[model samples]
Target: MIARTKIKPVLYHVVAVLLGFVMIYPLLWMIMSSFKPSNEIFANAGTLLPKKFYPSNYTTGFRGFGGISFSTFFKNSFIISGLSTAGSVFSSACIAYGLSRLRFKGRKIWFVMMLLTMMLPFQIIMIPQYIIFNRAGWIGTILPLVVPAYFGGGFFIFLIMQFIYGIPKDLDEAAKIDGCSFYGIFGRVILPLIVPALITSAIFAFMWKWDDFLASLLYLNNPSNYTVSLALKMFSDPSTQSDWGAMFAMATLSILPILLIFIFCQKYLVEGISTEGLKG
Candidate 1:
């Protein structure tokens, strides 16, 4: 039995290591290929280590396309993503607090409708949304992409609502006895305790907005207004050919913020959906 237990753990770890390699192989290839000379990319595709790295991929990506600069793309990405996250998190927290805590007529119906809205796919509404925004003169502006964050996005609302529901009602009752209003209880009491859920919501929102290509493409026509994802598309070409090396480098760069977000919030993302499922 002792021997079997030891052998099982060793086997498990070996399997885990193999799976890890499989998962990371693409990213490793992308990073290494970013260093290779454009000619050798296809020839030496099998190797984990590139034979020669044209470090200029990094340099060229920054100024590779005319004088456009990667910095401009980075700036647009950060601005849109940061504001959207802030707007989503704050608005979602506030709305979720009310939905999960407050007592009012027709609240059940409203909650059910919120869940129904989530079930609806964005594809179904895209045309109508585009038309509405276009008529409002928001087509070429960042407004369409950024403004919706204030209304509390569906997913974030649901996430924060789960966190709010997990919070014990006794705490709110106690706060009420201590002369706290519902708003105060939400702000000072409930908000402080659900930092994990808040961070989780914020991280998800940031990622959603940052990596978004469709909305950015649809809303912003000018190359100067492009987000990193839209800008990244500039790397692809038919004639002179897309520099896979620089493209991979920029791809890696694009995912960095998302990776950082998960690394930072993962410590608190420990709680699961069960915590959110409970109701008082």
Candidate 2:
């Protein structure tokens, strides 16, 4: 029995390690290929390690095209992601609070509508949204990408509502006894307690905004306004030899922010997700 037990754990760990490596292999290959020469990128496709470390890809990619630098693309991504994250987190929290705590007629109906919206894919609304933005003269600007985030995303609102549901109603009653208004209760009592959920929402919002390519492509026509995701697409040309090394280099760099955020805030994310359903 002792021998079987030890062997089972060893086998489980071996399988787990293999699965982990399989899942992460593509990312590892991309990072490694970025250090290779443009000519050798495909030539050594099977190899994970580069024959020679070519740092020129970083320089070439950073130069960018049409006289704009990669720095501009990075800055644009940061701006859109930061604003969208802030807007989504704040709006979602407020909406979640209302739906979870406030008693109103048709509240269940509104909540159901919000849940239904989550089932509708972005493609279903893309054309109508584009037409609306074009009419509003928001085309070729970041407005189309950033403005909708302020209205609260359905998924985020749902996530935060679950978190809010887990909170005891006694706190709200206590705040009310202290003469605090609903807004005051939200800002002072609930917001402070729901830090984990808020941070979890912000992380998802920022990562999604940062990696959004289709939205950026549709809204941003000017190269000056291009985000990192859209700018990366510019590296490929079907008519000419594409610079694979530089593309890979920039791609590697693009994921750093997301990786760092997850690494740092993973604890909060896990806590928020695990505990949100405990009461709800």
Candidate closest to the true structure, highest TM-score = 2
What is the overall TM-score of model 1 with all chains considered together? Answer: 0.93
What local lDDT does model 2 show for residue 260? 99
Candidate topping lDDT: 2
Q: Tell me the spans in candidate 2 whose CA falls farther than 4 Å from its real position.
A: 277-280
Deviation in angstroms for 197 in model 1? Answer: 0.5
- Model 2, span 1-280: residue lDDT tens: 9999999999999999999999999999999989999889888899999998998999999999999999999999999999999999999999999999989999999999999999998889999999999999999999999999999999899998888888888888999999999999999999988888999999999999999988998999999999999999899988998988899999999999999999999999997786563341
TM-score of each: 0.93, 0.97
Tell me the tens digit of each residue's lDDT in model 1 across 1-280: 9999899999999999999999999988888888887778888889878876588888878774766889899999999999989998999888888898889999999888888878998788889999999999998888999998888877778888877777789888999999999789988898887787887787778888998998898899988889999988888887877787788778888888898877877876665333453355
The CA lDDT at 264 in model 2 is 98
What is the C-alpha local distance difference test score of each model?
Answer: 0.84, 0.93
What local lDDT does model 2 show for residue 110?
96
- Would you list the clashing residue pairs of candidate 2? none
The alpha-carbon lDDT assigned to residue 230 of candidate 2 equals 95
Question: What C-alpha lDDT does candidate 1 achieve relative to the native structure?
Answer: 0.84
